[model samples]
Target: MKSLITAPLLLISGFLFLTLAAARPQLNVLMISVDDLRDWTNFLGGYDGEVFTPHMDALAERGISFTNAHCPSPVCNPSRTSVMTGLMPSTTGIYSNSQWLRPNHPEATTLPQFFKDRGFKVVGSGKSFHHTAGNNPPDQWHDYFRFPWADFPWTRSNKLNYPWTEWQPPPPEYPFSKVEYLRGKDERDWGILPRKESKYDDVVIVDYAIDFLESHSGDPFFLSVGTFHPHLPWYIPKRFHDLYADSEIQLPVFPENDLDNIPPIPRKWAEARRDEMQAARDAGEWEEAVRCYLASISFADAQVGRVLEALENSHFAKSTIIVLWSDHGFHLGEKGHWMKSTLWEEATRVPFIIATPGMENSGQSSSRPVNLVSIFPTLVSLLSLESNTDFDGPDLTPLLANPDAEWSHPSLIDFGYGNTAVRNEHWRYIRYNDGTEELYDHQTDPNEWKNLADHPMYQKVKDNLAEYLPESYTENVPGKNAFVFDPENWTFTNKETGRVVHGRQ
Candidate 1:
């Protein structure tokens, strides 16, 4: 009789355990991606003047802000591919925007695919991946909208046939900034768009995200909402431009001899956009360009606010995890560069924040040097998913739990095949493909105005940071010139090797 009673009690306890486990809700992920956003927000304080970023600042308050986060690569295609696939550019050979991900790496499971495989409703809109035709495969998500500018009339009319094309026809007085160099070049131009903000691509993308948040109910979701603002052609609504007064706009500190200490490789990177910088300076439109960028950032912040408001109103708000990050940082006349693709502090340091449900250390900040490559594995850990050994980055759950955890790992930023930058808490060490190096002690030079790699005193420091560099870099895969891409069939045929690879439609 005693044995029978014991058996019944044990069965009841086991049933209760299973029931509790089954009733627990799975954590959903809301990934917000901002393209080419640097550390200029109100929180990061990378800028000198007032930058309107209330939404991003509030989001930082809700999570652990990684102040030292850097991209896996300093360019879009390579950096996004590395973040999504959990592989470094050095390992995948995806070192530039010209190379397509699917044609080169067919087997790597992307972050969304990892969740989708485990029964999550994956959806995305806007420039989540590189906003190119072949780079963002459809099968990665259950539903996705490509960089929405492709649907605009100006884009469809071939007036500007690029993904980052102007969303609408320029105002008749084009080059609104009155800079002659930007007259025909739409990519570099920035001005007030004489239209309603509702019609913009970033606004439309945020609307899609809001709709999904409101209506989503079934399986846990992995929703990616990407904003393509503050990227290029900073053309935005007039209201955003109104936020910044020209008198309040402060230009970045431009040292006349800033490039004198760097190696030849990065010197070339600085000179790459010198002509554009010169034109802006020559026209005295530098302040206007900075104002446009600030306005664009405010515009992007508004879009993020829309999505956050929708999520808060939805039922999934309490159960969801919010991860906001930029693909890579931008250089707005810093280091004498106008765009990304450099391995400098401005080009590599991005805005990274992860807000998990019921986080104990909320509103805290972490200065641990972390790479965006950790995003994939970090999400996998947060969701309690099976670990994959193929990830080159470590699980960042430890840092999430404790912002000041003992983390020795340095953030690695790769540019080209052999050009890499290792950034830890104190120093930034850059090694070019040709073996020339540049080292800056961040302790003394936060602006990186000086190079210390040539000094024997910092040789030990350089050696310590150099250990984090890639042991070997993979050779670059076939670029667009080496393959014929058939958009109709979604396939790439290598011209020389005759190898055919099918891409997801």
Candidate 2:
């Protein structure tokens, strides 16, 4: 299928910052990012019944799959910042979606920029870093396509052809089109697109990536192909939806009293989605909503298939290293919560896979609890690239070499100040701002249903896990373009004119 948007043979932007020696053999890197995808794929088995994701499962078979991977933060901006910069959100003071990292943490080196500094060609397209251009360093790439996204992103030329008014990722509330099953208003919506596949923005991204892969041969390139699907509004092609039957769709295992057992902070967050859940139940659209999400994921998988095929068919396939990951996990009404931005397992857990060409021991699943915060260092270690700075997460070469490596490093997940969750092999310990705690034994309760934080028997467990939380943390950084944050008072002031805006906690 062709892109509905104007066909560009190539989307190239970036200048050569460093020079590569003629004799050196550079390794190519292919980074694939899927937005808001949870562990519902066939390989993860988090979701019951059937979820169609053949391409991703195939990719998992070709690399070391981190079965127990979690994002630093559940939100898009902060999670991407941590992964790209290899810096934790607490250290950088970037906690919210509005907070931009490039300005807040200027000294840190990004994953692609690190490669660029090492005399490698970096190319990117679509949503690599938080969907904001500022998060993506313009000068770091050899070539990049900043625009050209799924379904009428911008451009007055094709505006009339597509219905911008009705078709989009939900407006955080009800009234879904096409699925007709959703009868009432609620938070989050979904629908299948009736237009041409070329209109899809992600398809254009793959096209640009394929163009680069086929044309470029000798230079070591770091290609980032980002896909914005299965994120929200669940807008996707009808054909992908056909792959799944509604009868085969399985609903999430939502406990009736899950929120009652949740800690204060997360319980409060989960309560906000009460209206959304209630609406879903009232309308009997629970399965329909999940159906669209799974379909959108399958659509995303198809895009991955397209990009991988291009890379495999390319001359550099044998020497390239492929790393596929999502910014964070999504919540399809798991913990009575609708979306991400919590310290729970559903929101923080993500799909992380690393495939290096000719690795002796490949296609293994490492069940070790690992955080995505150190993706920068992990890649650097795998590629043997040089960096001027250190990273929060260390070299996982040992784990990659041996999936059952004895690792004591527990995965740490955080959301703003005073709230953190530490996940080890067995336990998930959560400490909120109010000094209250919640713990879950993953071995007995994979769904994290039973909060054993107050269990007298597990006090030692909490003490030991508390050791993994961040030692030092700054107040949340306010966006320079948007607002100014006062760490001392936990308040937000207007950026311009220094007027007192509002107090935040």
Candidate 3:
């Protein structure tokens, strides 16, 4: 009887020890992406004096804010592609919005796909990829939500108000509310998306994300919530719009002769788009447009706050890693351009925040210039998961673990089809495929208002950054030109060569 009791006790004690030894804590990831969000806020304090993003300010207050974070490319598709695949836009050959990523890079491993392979339930909603909504791979998610913006009353009214208008607001067949701020203005006037009290698309995204958390109880999960506002025709709820009135809102300062030192191609491109911009300005639509953009950003922030709240309240809060990023930055009438297709800071610097469990209380900042491509490998290292072979970025786990640690590479930004720009600690170097270049000492010219490329005093600085440019980009690709719009016709393909050959190239 004594031997039997001793044996049972020993067995129980051994089991307990092993359980304690092998047990890994629960881990979850909350990745929130906002479209066209620029890093011109209180965090980096990039703006001359603007104070818009309060929720993002709070986020920066809680975690790490990458002062020099940038997209792989200035355009959406390539930027998002680089972000998801951990490959630079050049390596992936996804340079423009017209270029579809699926057929071209089918073999590429996506950020969420990697997590899914590790037994984590992954769910996505809104616009994570460029048009992933219409042509999403069924296997990408355990489940996904694609809510229609059609039911928005503002979208319905826009069509009626501007019958000849080429740009219509989203469709109005879906369920949402029309939250109005100003008394008598039509939905189009305010440029605000309609919303149902708590059922807005942004709100819905958070709702589903939190719901996933509840259902997955003990299992690890990866939730990616993409907010579509603050993109085009910047629309937001009325309450957000009222946050900035006409007089209170400041217009983007139009730099006098900003194009004076830029190259011919970029300068000419800006000039070509001048007519449409002037039309909007002449009609007093630009400021309203700017106000709408600011409001949309605030709207996106509120949605972000919801997700953060859920994470904090969940049991997995102590173990989860929260990352929020914008697909790429946008130009709100900067460089006489209103979109994201240039190497300018307005078009390249995106909002990046990473909040880890143990590091949650450690709010820090890094001006270390890292690309969005680094996200994949960093997550892999953070989770200590099985390593894979498909990656073109370095794991930034060391940097995040100790941001003050030394790094060898400067972050590269692929702007236009072949234009490349790199941000070092103190300088911004840009090189166009046509052999044109621009260099600016960010310390002296924070706005990049002056070009030091021609200045002989900083020749060494320029040479160092140039050496950092990848040779892959300098080498030519098949059926491609250095400065043409689309080197590879992404929409259509050639039968004989299996390459994109016809349309834009």
Candidate 4:
């Protein structure tokens, strides 16, 4: 009687009825998460239009693919924390990879916790939550396994000197042919691993996840598979590296003056990695980097293939809801930037797909814009859970059911205090702390190479999109004592010298 979502009854007596507390079948959930995966796939046409994401392409073929999906935040920790907690980085004060939602928003119920509370057995491995200590507390997941770097020979061999700051290549694992030129030698090594599939970190995760799937196939379970690849160091097996050729690699079209007309804040943000892009271009390593990134994508794709195969081969395939998404997008020499933390499309626009077991229009795609923060409510709706978890974005079930349905939700990407981007159906509007703005018509400029904020013709468009920016950016919540927020009037201040900073008080 307590399990409203699942219950069973029995009747046998002549004039009486009996009730039995039996476990009723519920839809199984398989959540696949990737790190730093941009649109450089066979479906998204992100990188040189030659990407080989066959596995992801296959998933998209039968799933509802949102073409304009974006991340809540461009960085890792904040983005994942936001998605898991169903809250925005602005609301939680978790705006960077160094910030964890568990400590910042202690009382918030996470996605996994919600599922566990609703009588679903939750199991996860690898990078599901924000890294240092996952965004979800240990008690949330019935079974939580964090795979170690030392568990994989390839990762253990090339250990980070500081691990967090630098990578130190010890002895070669098995003579993997590596890229000749890499800008950040420590963090950008690309090569092939000669060891068996079990020696890779991602493979280990798949193995654990597959076993979990087999064990909990009958019961209602929430299984998560997180893959860390195409992220950095591009260390994949030689076979995957061979899938992409240096000559076929196509660098993003980054005009020398692409940032010339943009506002100073956004321009300065992209310029943060200007030197890295310049070094690659000058040394003719740009294509090599792209090739490495492409190979990493393929490698991650293969992992997807393995997991999906495992799911399909199991008993819970048809009765499962599969949701695959990346924490945020990545930049492969786009706008003179190498990694995320920018509000541009390259850093925010991500690949998102959902496959409900028996949906009518499963394989179609939607151009309507959606953000990662919506995944929580979307799944809650899909699973039909009765929980009142306040979410910043709307449930995407309608978009999934009908790709062409009316969707008015604009995607929000919060990078830091007073820096955010609002992406709608055809326009992207950005407003910085100094009141400067950048507007891009995605219809005309998908690459975002041109800045039309100064154009007099688009004043109304800017005004319409700017209305969706976060009501109040709590503060930049990553580092220590960098920003102090005054909630009275929604303003930030410099704590060091007690000076009112970013935005008007």
Candidate 5:
């Protein structure tokens, strides 16, 4: 009798232990961010010519890709701030790169801090946050590796004590492109850097991330790895540039009257960078510039491949979740623009992919429009953490389970104070601060060449999309000039008001 009772008790205890472990299993997160990467990968087909991004393509094959994902704002600071804080630009008032995020909203919980608060070892490297002073606070992460800005040797030295400006120029072979107009220009130029791939900063950044993944032994971790490539001064190793040397470079279609029907505000935004576009065209460097961009994309993709390989080989492979996204899209002479900061598809549309362990619908894509702001809440739900009610976006778990789930929320893109764009499955509607409107039917005009906002037939469509816009706009936050920040102390002093606010330490 005693032997039988002891055997049944042991079985019951073993079953209870297994059930508890299954209920709350440890889940790790690996988030990869690429800067200025648009929808030009082999998966998205944003580029017309042949593009090589095997690593990202392979990751997409094993993950659920959101084909219609967009950023909360087209600019860097606001978009990244939205992703970190789970707040939109209209709510946070951080509309541009110059506006610091911590000074404006210090009480908000960042994505890293959320995980860190819940006993996760949160750490990251590279341009995970806006690469500006006072933007990336110390309290958000248990550990972080700041980006090495000295990698780019051509930029101007910061004489005015500005952020990310103190850098020495390279040796005599400075402007490798040798384009006449791009001779002295810093960020606009691109060429082959005469160096080994190991010396590159992105490679270094990935090395740090890989080291962490291989050696981390503790509670579950949230590892963020960001790469600043294809953003500006598109310099990469010679081998990467050589990969595209023999291929035919196809530039984006720039119609003669592309800006004819745009409103004044966005029309000015497009025309703002027209001189850069024209200079490249006149110098006959258009194809070379596009090639450099594609090569940079390939280089970034290689770094991504390295990180993925590290994760796969690690002991945490089966329990980790991988997510890859770009802060915002890039505009390579699309719609008469050279870079981001426009509300058009070229600047707003980005590559978003998420892969979780044991996902039934892995390797599928969702056409439903989504925004990056949902990252925080979705992670909360995925990790079974306590939910925060202040997230501006909804949880995307349903879409993760079923790619074709009924998702009604369209992706919203905000630029300035009142400039907003609404993108759905078939239409894109823009409303400027001056109340001017522009609408394009993606089914017919994927290029957004024609503006149907003036057409009386699309009034209902405009009104229906317009209802999704923000009802009230938050005032612009204080610009960089408005405060004197002390990085060591993590404090901000208003220039005019002389008010001191303690930042995250």
Candidate 6:
């Protein structure tokens, strides 16, 4: 009788053990980013012009592709700040590229910080932040490693070379040379190359990411690897450039009369950027720019492939969530915008593909307008994380489960202070604080050939989008904390309340 009782107890205990094992956290995350990568790549449904990114194509094929994902802002700093903190530019108070984000909100909980708080080993490297200057927060990362090939070489400065410039690395098998400089570190003009194989930022960053996986052996970890390429000076070794020729490359589709219908603000912006691109093309340097951009993208793609390959090769493939995205897209002379800071589709829209473990259906696509801000809540839902009310983004896991899930909110894009745009499936709407507005029907005008803001019929649609914008902004007001960073410049304060604005302010 005692033996029987013990056997039943033992069976119950075994069942409980299995239950715990199944319920225990066995998740890992790998978030990768590329700089100035637009939707022009063949993989992300970009037009087949001069570029081919097979690795990215493969990654997109295995993940849930968000065709209309956009950044909070067009510029790098604010956009990245939004992604990192999962907060809008108004709330975060990180309005521009020059402002240092951390000092403004020292107590704020970043995405990495949240994951790190949950006992996950968080590691970051490369251009994950806005400026790529200063040390990372301790709470956000348990370990941080800078990738070697991750940064640009200072020897190939665009400003230094001026008119006729081509950035080239050292010849054959002997990677780019590293030259250390202390004078202009924070200035955007400076670049740096890697020393040895181990020093290559991309190689080093990925190596450490894979190393983190091996070290944990089976534990969960969150690793963020940022690749800085395809940005400016389009610097890469000759081998990558050699892969393409002017004959094989097709120019971007920018019509001569492309600006007929666009709003004045956007038209002017695009025209300026287009001229810069035209100068490069006229100087017989368009192919060089294209080759370098594509090569850098391909190079970054190769690095990404390695990380994904490592996961598949390791035991973590079954439980890892791989998210690859660009902070914002770059322009290869499309829409007249050369390098972001515009509200056009090319500059605002980004490539967002997520390969979640255990998600059976692959190669799924969603037309829903989603913002990078949604990344926080999406991860929380996927990981079955503890509920928290602080996060503003809604869980997008349902979309992953059913690609046709019902999600109908227009994704919002922020420009400079008081400028905002809302993108829906059929229409794009914009409202500037100076009372300027723009509207475009994407179906009729994909290239924004016509601005329908003056049309009387679309008033309802414009009003609808305007309602989505915050009526009265709250939280991170510019002047309150901005002076800490830049004392000379006066930020936009609450005109009415005299106190810092609230609610998207």
Greater-lDDT candidate between 1 and 3: 1
Q: Can you give the lDDT of residue 142 in candidate 2?
A: 77
Which segments of model 4 are wrong by more than 4 Å? 1-25, 134-136, 151-169, 172-186, 477-505
Select the stronger candidate by lDDT from 1 and 4: 1
Off by over 4 Å in 1: 1-25, 150-171, 387-389
Candidate with more favorable, higher lDDT: 1 or 2: 1
TM-score on alpha carbons, each prediction = 0.92, 0.85, 0.81, 0.84, 0.93, 0.80
TM-score of model 2 vs. true structure: 0.85
Best by TM-score: 5
Ranking by TM-score: 5, 1, 2, 4, 3, 6
The window of 10 residues in a row where model 6 has the poorest summed lDDT is 1-10
Give me the displacement of residue 258 in model 1, in angstroms: 1.5
For candidate 5, what is the TM-score? Answer: 0.93
Better of 2 and 5 by lDDT: 5
| Candidate 5 lDDT over residue span 180-295, tens digit each | 66666657778887777897889999999999998999899999999999788898998899899999998888898898888889878987777877888898888898999999
Find the number of clashing residue pairs for candidate 2. 8
Alpha-carbon local distance difference test for all models: 0.83, 0.74, 0.67, 0.73, 0.84, 0.65
Tell me the tens digit of each residue's lDDT in model 2 across 328-377: 88777888877788788889888898887765457789999898886776
lDDT of 6 by residue, 1-505 (tens): 0010111111111332233236545677889888878886665666576565787788878888888788888888888877876677766656676565555555566778778888787888776775333224444677776433333443344421111224444333222212122123322221222334344556667777677666665447888888776666455555555666444665567776777655566666676645556556665666556666777777777777887888788877777888888888877777655677888788888888888764555787888888887787677666666533354445567667767778867888887766788998888898876777888888888766677888899899899889888554333434423332211222223344443311110
Steric collisions counted per model: 0, 8, 8, 1, 0, 20
Off by over 4 Å in 5: 1-24, 159-166
Which scores better on lDDT, 3 or 4? 4
TM-score, predicted candidate 6 vs. hidden true structure? 0.80
- How displaced is residue 235 in candidate 3, in Å? 1.6
| Candidate 3 TM-score, C-alpha based | 0.81
Per-residue lDDT for 333-400 in model 3, tens only?
77788667778788888889887765623578877888888887677766666444455566666556
